[model samples]
Target chain A: MSLPLLEVDDLHVTFNTASGPVHAVDGVSFTMESGDSLGVVGESGSGKSVTARALLRLFAITDDVRIAGSVRFDGVDLLRIDERKLRDVRGGQIGMIFQDPLTSLNPLMAVGEQIAESLRLHRGMGRSEAAAEAVELLGRVGIADPERRATELPNSFSGGMRQRVMISLAIACRPRLLIADEPTTALDVTVQAEILLLLDELRRSEQMALMLITHDFGVVAATCEDVQVMYAGRLVEKASMVHLFDRANHPYTEGLLRLVPRFEDAHTGRLHPIAGQPPITGGGGSSCAFAPRCSHAFDRCRSEVPPEVAVGPQHLSACWLAAERAKDATEAGRPWKRDP
Target chain B: MSAAAARAVLEVSDAVVEFDTDGGRITAVDGVSLQLSTGETLGLVGESGCGKSTLARAILQLVPMQQGSVRLEDTDLGSLSPRELRRMRHRIQMVFQDPRGSLDPRMSVTALIGEPLRVHGIGDRASRAREVAEAMELVGLPALVADRLPSELSGGQQQRVGIARAIVTDPAVLVCDEPVSALDVSIQAQIINVLDELRDTLNLAMLFIAHDLSVVRHLSDRVAVMYLGQFVETGTASEVFTEPRHPYTQGLITSVPRADTESAARLQTARRLVLGELPSLLDPPSGCRYRTRCPYATDRCADVEPPPDLLDGHHAVRCHHHRAITAGEHQPSSKSMRG
Candidate 1:
């Protein structure tokens, strides 16, 4: 098989804080084929965003920061690439859209200038050519009257309009990969739906692989093919969208799925909130980080870290319960899966 | 006091709050009316600029309403002097959105919870100390952390402290404005569960305002869909979810992705979206505030605003074509902009 467009293997990112080394993105490994979408789903401090940011070596400048393992994109090691080369890769090969479009865009410059800046720098387009291209890109992303709207300051644009501009800039260079970190978190629900649809359309037409980093599971289900559930810093579960939902192995994943209020079904029981806060990463060593919060934790979970074992073909879960309850998933008509 | 006033712990009618800005006057909370009975939750769901927060503030008399009546139990809050208002505030407490911001950074958890009791003159120092421990235990926090500051607590813990402080006075009405929106999904459930339990134990009347309708459904006995500066729909939670009358309500509900696996699958298919420029409420539409983005908006809508008239005894909708929309007779030109 051809090499995946992006391969993240055994990635680890740690930050040195006063208390101890904050282990964010611990041993996260995943691969996305060209045009494939992978969603990194996690709660706050779960390292999803850190994993996405590390691809661009965003942590390198910060002091006492450590990042290990490999992030291969189009046969180049993103982690090892020099700043000069990485600059080319940044807008030319990979683009990023962060949450809060209000803060992401430059207030001093017109919105068009920001989009054209990327095109001019990355593709070496002339000023006029980039400006024309920027308007078309804006229109392509569903912004109305893009030609005029392009010249207006970001403050003039609505929240939804600003987000569309952010998306326009991220896709201006026609990058191979786009990392969107909660692109719609700050947007209204109606606007979020439109943005999600716009991104899906862009992904399909451009054949760009997407790394969607969001805490919202529904957004992942709508946009991604492959899903990775992060807990503490480790990838607790990784599977296709269907497998993640239908035969989720990790207790955390199941609890997460159950906790969300759904309009489609009548949720009569008290919401089953996972007991206790997410464990603060530091000072603790070698044990399952999720053990203390996990309801199914046993002596084995506390003493030794469980290795990721396959529950289904290509579906892996890093929980001791996955080994014990492998038959449970298959019994629920998920016959393709096996007990680890 | 009317007989209905006896039942409703907090009642607001024709509440209108406006702010004078450099551009013009902005009506943050339009002529809106709502009531909350003891142990009942009336969830106000809306987008950021839709005045849900402003309405909550208006109800609490935190902000003065230019034209409205806020009756807390038998007392008319607007007529009260500042001194009397301060004295009356103990009857109705507010839980703010940001736990960190609402709580004083310098105060210990003990001091934070005890402040309300001390302000209300509910108990003596020793009794207040005993009550502070009781409040901590009620919200599931250990008594040992009473001395700890708000900064030392996690997001969920801080929210629990916020909840504990709101409930410490045993206020009859609780106006929680997006209390759990800042928390994680798992932690959101824990907070929701805690509030749900507290509602039963305290028999409190709550006005829960949040943007997420799903969370509102879990907690609210009734739901009000707000847009711009006005509510377009109000009904029982099940009624609003299952058979929404207004197109804006339809679009809003359809937009949120449910956690169920089937919803994800359903989301893959083509869907209608309610999207148009949300008009500046500074110069809002002549009639319906949502008329600009509304799919079923007609010339009549521009001429006059549709009042939220009750359909059955409980369900109310402020739409010209609500009945037709629910009957599947009024087919919007853009089917996706159902709300």
Candidate 2:
């Protein structure tokens, strides 16, 4: 079989705080094939962004951080790569689009110069060639009057337009994989839709693997084909997009889905909010992290971590209740009932 | 109707706000009018730079208006003296979007919620504490959180405190400006539920403003869609969202990612009506503000402004091509209606 574009196995990331060591990412594993889209979804502080950063080794992991995992891309181990090689792989092979375009783009430089710099460094193109490619990239991403916009500073562009510039910069070298972390959070709904469509078109045209990190499931439902649900630094569920929406095995996923407002819902009613906050991790050798807020928690769930249970052809969930529910539904010849 | 029964909690008529910037004169709000009946919820939705927040600030008399009038139960807001306006402030309150920025950093939650009651001279120290506790409970915040600072609480908890402060004075009207936009999806649900419960118990007439069409669709009794500085469409939430008449309104609704089975295909087919960047408020386009991006734009669209066409008793849209657009006569090749 062909090798996956990216594969992360048993990844663990920890942070040292005054109180103790915070286990940010614990035993998260997933793989993305070429041209496949995977969504990493969770609330803030759930380690979704941390996991994305870990792929590129962006975080400052001093003596405080204890990273124990293997991240392999294109049959090469990323975690063990040297600094010079890692630098080459970071922007050349893998590109990342951050949450805020205003902060990501340099205020002092012209938008075209920045994209040209990326092209020159990664692709080793000459200055004049890079300038032409920069404008072409800008136009490719649907920026109007790209030649003029390329020379303009980022401050002149709106948030949506700046985001388009960021995308142009990210894809300047034509990386094999692109990681987008809440790229549209700062945009309005209409602009957000346009950006999403643009990303979808680019992904299809380039056949590049995409790892979209977002808290908004609506975004994932719109673009992603595969999804991984994270909770309190652990991967709770992994499934195909269709299966996850049709039968969300994890309780946290169900709660999240219910929380999203639907058009058909009554205008005024009590929303069913998940009670209690996510637990704070003090160390790395703990049990299941979501035990505190999970309604399906049992004695074992509190003391011992549950193993990944297969739910469908490629779907897996780390919950005792999910396995039982799946079996019950299968035996009864009925689909799993969703909680309203 | 009896005098007591007929009093509107807040009424705004022909309200217009303009700003003089370096570029030119900008009409942020133009002839926009609305009324807040007691114990009613009105949701205002639009894309960014649509002047929804400007209209909210105008009602609170925070933003100076060039023309129009605001009345709180027959008291002319524009005519009120400075002292009279200060006295009238107790009857109406506002909750801002950023809870962390809105609340005082140095103050504890107790002090923040208690400030309004103290300013209004509603009760003594002991009674004030009791009232604070009651307000906390009303917003579903635990009493123990009263001692915490805004930074110590989570986003959802901080917003509850914001609501508690707004409702502490028993104001007849509450203007929530995107109260839950900064929160998590689950936390947004909690805050929305708290607002719903508070409205029913306290009989609050709320002016809810948000950019998310889905959230507004699930929260508002009547929804108004704004474009540039004008109201493009206004109707009951169900009518406006389900059967939008204005091209801008229909475009906004179709843009939201729905959970229907056909959403994927419909998303591909829906035409993006609004294009380019929002026009600079300092020099808005003449005639129809949306004419710059409208697909069905004609020569007349740039010369004559389209008046609000009454689609139904409660529905209205301001668009010259509303009939052709809504009737599917000039429908785009890819338009599909998803749930």
Candidate 3:
């Protein structure tokens, strides 16, 4: 079989601060085939965004921060590559969009020129041709008047419009993979729908792989085909979209699924909020990180780290409960009913 | 009707607030009338520029309404002198979206919660200290948090401090503007629960403003949908959310992404694509502000605006095509209705 488009193995990112070493991303590993869409769902400080950034090596290089892992893209290890080669790979092979477009874009530069700069740098397109292509991209992203908007500064554009501009800039090179970090969080629900639709369209038409990092599962359900649930800087569960939703194995994943309020559950009375906040990452130990907040946490969970084991075909969960279930099934020589 | 009128603690009539922008006069809240009875929660839902926040500010009397009469317990705030309004401010309080931004970073938690009591000059040093500690405990904060700065607390803790400050004076009406939007999902539930419990036990009138339809539905006894500076629909939460009449309100109901598997499945099966974004408030459409993005726009919709129609004595909708639309006439495009 052909190798996967991108494979991240034992990826770890740590920040050394006055408090201690903050292990922002603690040993995350996943693989994405060509044209596949993977979602990383978690709350803030869950290390989803940090993991995505590590794929592109976007964090500032410094003595305070330690990054150790293997990120193989197109048969080449991105982590081992030089900075110059990585820069070439970033805009050409992988493009990223952020939650806030205004902060990402330069206020002084015209919207069109900002996007055109990428085309010139990556594809070496001439000035006029790049400018024309930028306008075309703006129009493709559903802008009402692309020709005029291309000349406007970032300040003149609305939030949704600015987001569209950011999308255009990202897709200017038509990269193989796109990392969208809460791309629609700042927009209205209606506007968010439109943006998601655009991203879906781009994914299909370009056969582009996507790493969608977001807190909202609804957004992920709409966009991603494969799902990975992260908590306390670790990937607790990874499975196909259908399996992950129906058979949520990890207690943390299950807690998040039930915690978020739904429109239909308007009068359902009392949301099941996960008690207490997520623990601070980077604590040295073999103990389970989520034991404090998990309802299914046991004595073993508090002292020993659970290895990710196959709960179902192609579905993996890192929880002692899953291990217990597997042990019971093997001992009984038949499948056993899981507790509710 | 008589009972509601008798129990009404806050009444706003023909409220109009205009801003003098470079683009000329923009009416943020226009001719909106509403009544808030004692211990009732009124949820105001709208998109970003629909003027929900402006209406909240107008009711708080923070900004001068160009023309309107705001009566709090039969006292017209417009007629009150500056000093008189200041004296009356203690009974009315607000909780803002950003807990940290709304609170003073320099002040300790105790000082922040006690400032309202001090300004009203209700208690002496010893009594105020007792009251401050009580308020902190009331909102589920520990006594030790009183000495910490605003920055030292988490988002949820900061919001509790905010709620404590608002209720310390025992305000008759409390206006919360997107109180939980900045918080995480679990924390959001905690804050929402606190607000709901406080409203019920304290018998306080509340105007809960939020863009999230789900949260508003949970908290509000009555709900109002605003579009381009006007109240398009208002009714009991169940009636308004379940049987939304206004097209704008319907779009909001069907657009929200839900978490429950049943609704998510239903949404996936019957998901409708919602149309365009809200137009700029600077140049609103003639007659019907929503018509620009509305799918059922007709000649009448553009020519003359339909006046508000009251149904079942409580439910109100402002749309000429609401009846036909509700009857499934001129079926909405697959684009806007999800579930």
Candidate 4:
């Protein structure tokens, strides 16, 4: 029937740094339907944020950056569209919230005015009408006494309140897609739960597709139905939330999962930390980027990159061992042993 | 004396720290007290502005306290002479949250780790350099990176340097204030392992202050839950995590996101969900600071302040309704402010 709400095909983003060309987001592909929630998990420099920003052409201003591949959102290829149309699509159809609200929100303006400005530009409301809607939006985001709080500057609000103002600004136009990049990373656990619940409620009420990019697996399990695990700017694993936790196929995914200390693991002797840091690859290579740090890596992983293989329905893992084990399990007529 | 008392390297009692801000006087550490024994980890956890950091600094005597005392192995830190205090400071050291910001970008790693020893006149220059190299190796940093600046090191390596500097003095107690919060998840695990190894090897008692519940539970022997400059609960790690008594402790535990899918629904139904942000320190709630957002709060919570009442041996809870709440006798009168 109809196409998905958002389809990303072989996305690649490279930046010309002082050292050399850095392939930050390399050949990532995914799709999302309306009301779908997808979590992108990766460590710093894994290029999770770069992929999300590339969709909105947010990197157009950077002089030494190259973004390639098709990003089709609601039938329009966002990359090929003109600057004017892209502006209309930016905050109007695809809203985004960043990690830190202090830098994202305008420091000089009143918090309400920033939201109103977006509404006036995107929704075509008059100044006064937009101002009233801004207050309402603030209240909708659970800000107390929105009328008075709206008049105050961004600095007057606490970290959590500033984030709420940012959320209000993003959803002022009721965009069809919401991209939240580490929205709760800077917030406390109590406030983070509140914010996540708020975002979940908004997504359901508006029927918007959500793409949440964060390093925390806990946040992903709590909010998303599907998830993609990234390592060294590559999509190493993609699966349903339950399936990912239950039967993660990629070594990187398994290692990352083990890194988190669970409440049940209290007094556990030591954390099973991945041995090495994520690499900063300057250019493309045939070998898998994560091979240096992966404990399960072998000669094939060091020589050539692995292709995406389906370990189960809707579960894709890019690893040679996973492919080999899948074959072995099929031959033996049994499920593959994860540890063995 | 008890075995715990005999082994304790740090003893802090009735510590009060206040600041004269433009809004008014704010009490950062309000009569907080704890004991940290050798080779033990006492996790001090709370939301931001809850005075966990202040308490850590007060223990180190970095911040001046309004009242109470901090003793380092029978020696009162507050009563020490200036020279003696400088010597006493060497027995306790701090590792800050932001490794890059805390470290000097201009200095090499060797100098950064050796500064404490140099300042304390612990050894000759050559001996200090040797100690620096050993400390770097102890934290899993390669010796080749000793000459590099903090800016050149990776986030994980920079944190290793921070840890190296803290232990270079061979401190009896190590106060890590959000040590791994700035790093990524994988890097955070590495740092935690390093800290764990160091604590065991050196027999260094650690005061691990963080907002991360899982990390605290992983490393701590005991846990103290702080809210609005006061400890709401203090108990063994297992008791605090599995059977949190205070409403604030329950709410905080519930807020943590779990990776397992089977427990997701259980976490939600068991959630206490304390609403709203931390209140202004200058004008905290009259009685229980957590009562403003606590679902089980009532008129008694506002009318009278609850002391830290000991229950079930050493598990202490600062809540008037904790006994009834644990007995299933008290009902929540108010819901969380929002979904």
lDDT scores of the candidates, listed in order = 0.83, 0.83, 0.84, 0.87
Q: What are the per-residue Cα lDDT tens digits for candidate 2 across A146-167? A: 9999999999998889999999
- The best candidate in terms of DockQ: 4
lDDT of 1 by residue, A1-340 (tens): 7788998898988888888888877888888877888888877878888889888887655557888999999878899988899999987789888899877789988999999998999999999999999999999988889999999999988888899999999999998999999998878777787788778778889999988999888888778888999888888899998777678888878777777675565436588777776767731358888888887899988999888999987789998889666678767754222222
Considering DockQ, where higher is better, how would the candidates rank from best to worst?
4, 2, 1, 3
For B272-309, candidate 4 gives per-residue lDDT tens digits of 54766678998999888889878889999998999989
Q: Candidate 4 residues A288-336, lDDT tens each?
A: 8888888778898889989899998899999988876655545654232
lDDT of 1 by residue, B1-339 (tens): 122443988889999999998889999888898888888888899887899998988888888899989999979999999999989898898887889988999999999999999988998999998888888888888877878999998888899999999899889999899999888788898888888888889988889998877788888888899888888898878778788888788878888875445554344332453646677877888977777777677788899889777877578999988888768787666644432
| Model 3 stretches with alpha carbons more than 4 Å out | A61-63, A323-340, B1-6, B260-274, B332-339
lDDT of 1 at A314: 72
Candidate 2 vs candidate 4: the DockQ winner is 4
How do all models score by TM-score?
0.95, 0.95, 0.94, 0.96
Which lDDT tens digits does candidate 3 get at residues A48-102? 9889988888886553777898999988999999999999988788988999999
- Model 2 alpha-carbon miss at residue B194, Å: 0.7
Best by TM-score: 4
Native contacts retained, all candidates in order: 0.54, 0.58, 0.38, 0.71
lDDT of 4 at B147: 90
lDDT of 3 at B327: 80
- Between candidates 1 and 3, the one scoring higher on DockQ is 1
